[model samples]
Target: MMKEGGCRPRAASPLKWLTQRPTRVTRAWCSGPASPAPADLWSTLKKALFIIGSSTIVFVALRNSLTYHLQHFWGASGDFWQHQWDKILHTYGDNPFTFMVYGTTIVSYVVYWTVGLLYTFVDMTGYPAILKRYKIQPGTNEPVETWKLIKCILWVNFNQIFVGVPFSMACFYLLRLRGWDESRQLPTFHWVIIELIICILMEEIGFYYSHRLFHHRMLYKHFHKMHHEWQSPISITAIYAHPLEHALSNMMPVFLGPLLMGSHVATIWLWVSLALLSTLNAHSGYHLPFFPSPEAHDFHHLKFNQCYGVLGVLDLLHGTDDKFRASKCFSRHLMMLSLVPPREAYPDVLPKGKVIRGKQCYDQPSEDSQ
Candidate 1:
């Protein structure tokens, strides 16, 4: 080597040679390619299945024990309801559909106003620091005007009376045509559970598809745009929508499951109450302790295109929740375990670097910016 060029090539050092390898190869080895979407989806699905299965087993076990202990109480309650139903039937000329319409309307009013007004009060007043800390999206309720609130209240009531009454009648008749037995005695706990599960599944499927359909460009302006008026909805805003959307997307999904199952009138009443409570909670704008987190639906309200389904199963399957899953809110998305503010309650989950205000999460700026 020295004879040819009048210089000797330095002996290659193994460590130096290794260090000089292609940077790309080294980087690639250290940080592998991102996991494929399908693998991530499968993992999500597995987690969901495990949670659902475990919950179902626990629910069944608890229901069995509770039903056995409360059999006499249930019997007494059923009898009391039957006596009340007799009076209602007599007053309404034995029209079960009329009873159903009246019952449903009354239940809706009670649940809506009781829960909705409490939330509205908080929205306007922002009092009782106890409840304020759990406020999922801050600053949303602060700027809402009183007249706008009143307008929403009036329109919601009007919808319940006009659109809701007719729709209830139609649903009752449809169930009748399908041979639903309105005169059946109070349903057994087992039958109620089975019917409820079916109803929930049907409602989830119907709501997801119909809700997504309403978001279509051709349909949204005329049918569903009103519902989206409240980007950060309060409890009362759950049913606030165009009459058409309320009928097809909101009411129909809740009714479809019961209709298909031919559930008893008593069971239907129970279902209606539970469904109303669930929706109110979702739209309440507060993520209180011991309640299901409203984050998913809240995110839907904020983003508009994601989390279209109630339980998120459909959204997950369809990848509509991809953005939601990536969000900071998702990291703090567990049910509130303590009464304290989420920041204090779950310090580990929501580290101090960022804060959630309204629909946005960002790093804390200086006090002047605040």
Candidate 2:
């Protein structure tokens, strides 16, 4: 058998084998034989509960502390809540609501922008290598252009702080002026949680329909196509869209539940902040194990007309993700690997597309296809 050419079958390298069989490791780490077993689901739920619970606790404590300091600073010595209100009334008189709206807007901006900056710093500095390693399926790793990023930021701010907030405040003041709300008691923690859940459900429903509509040929070009410019997106890309799209799809869904519930102002602030954080986390390209993966949503961005929901529940029910599943890229195993920098980034691995769906890759023929 020691015949002609000593061409023996080469042993597969460990890296090659892992790349070929990435799902094997993912299944062992995050699931069972079935797709995301009960244990896996429970683990994700527990993590979310812990984060929300812990953050709420810290936020309440800090707010109380700050209020106390502010009251003392103003030389007020009386009931805490009464003292703060009295001070605001004394200072702003008939325009207290104006000040309240301005304060909330400014505070929300500070929180949202602070979180955005931190994520940017982390990805740009310490974790660039880490981001590359675990990036979902191979795609572009190059940074988005500064001008494009600026456009996204400016448009988002214009919609959120300028248009959305003032419109919301006007509606709220009108409702109060008309004496529509009846229940005027301090809200309990249970009420906040319930309202938060309602808000999420509303977002899931509203965003699902609005997103699907935006993908239609008639509306896509005018309203939502600009957001599709980035096939592989970063965290800041979450709010990057036309102003009307932001209003219809992003802001309205989030605020609808709170508005209907007449939720406590504190609960509204907390829920809005959390929703912003959630969206930012979703658009963030990294797929850390402890955190929920952005693979599904990111896949939607990479491959249009699929997974068009705030959460995947609606998509699953409607079979919107079937094509994504068939692509072999939507596996949980690949999502878990999304945290690691790829062995090689896109272009080296495979060609990109204007839109990629299952076996077919399509080019942007017109503005609508973008």
Candidate 3:
């Protein structure tokens, strides 16, 4: 304690160490699950079951999503998925998010499938029944044909698949030859887990800014408007953005990997999961007890230029959340007004509103699940 460098020791502080080694323990722990923790077996079972169930729900929706450009692009395994999975089985790590148990690729598939079907219904007769039933606040009243909307959706997602798939495969092959992806299949699970977490952090930063850019007034009028078509009424229109916007938004995860570290399959899987979940949920349009809903995004669509992040934090940090604050404040005021007389616990009426242009407010909507 009395040493000259005692206050400024070379040894790192615990927090610093943990921060540096995010996978510190996970890597060590997964070497082999040989030493069983003495915790109740039932408890571990419950936790495992919970994780599996949650991952399944997300995957189911994502898996059902593939009806865009190719009605029969792959072949006769069953659908395109059969062909895709066959490829994945033959090349496990090579098959996109196969390595990621709750992979984003699957989730994206769900998102596309769900939206495609929804638009299909509305397109045949031009009725957004789904949107009308659940949407919080109404955005544009433009009549979007179902088939037309599908085409837009296809163009956007396909942009990523066409470009990013090849892009990733190229990167993967290059990284492998350089002997990068080869050594990490069994990285201390801890490091793998840590790397996953780090990838999330990095992607969050990348996505937040990228999402906000599309909201810029100039950009909004161009391709972005295509997406915000059905605000209150949930529409397949979520990913129906102009191809440029879609390309940029969907590829945030891909862009982040190299900036922070070498390209790794683990990183890709983790990134895919986060992106798919956030994107799909953002547009899932279903309000849940635990998570934010499409209405959360309905708010943004009604009043663009706010609500930016996948989860909604960046806006708060960057002094951009005033729109959300002011809207919530007014809505709360409206609730108070609707109250005073009866005070019966009010029903939630604040989903979205008629579209309105305004100052950039709300730090940024967390489009994480959008």
Q: Count the backbone clashes (under 3 Å) in each candidate.
A: 0, 9, 37
Backbone clashes in model 1, listed as residue pairs: none
TM-score of each: 0.80, 0.63, 0.51
Q: Could you give candidate 3's per-residue lDDT for residues 210-323 as a string of tens digits?
A: 777776666778867777665543345555666667557756444465435554554555456555555555664333334434434655665665566654445544434445
lDDT of 1 by residue, 1-370 (tens): 4424243333455543221212222322334444554686688788779878999899878986777766656567657756766776777676677667877888777877888888788788877757766777776777468887887888898889999899888988898898886773666766787898998998999999899888877899988888888888888888988888889988999998889998887788888888888898999888888898888898889888878899888776666776677665676677866666664554323345865556674323336744
Rank by lDDT (best first): 1, 2, 3
lDDT of 2 by residue, 226-247 (tens): 8888777777778888878887
> In order, what lDDT does every prediction score?
0.76, 0.63, 0.48
What TM-score does candidate 3 reach?
0.51
- Global fold similarity of model 2 (TM-score): 0.63
Worst 10 residues of 1 by lDDT: 17-26
Model 1's lDDT to the true fold? 0.76
lDDT of 1 at 242: 87
Best by TM-score, which number?
1
- 1 or 2: which has the higher TM-score? 1
Instruction: Name the lDDT of candidate 3.
Output: 0.48
RMSD of 1: 11.9
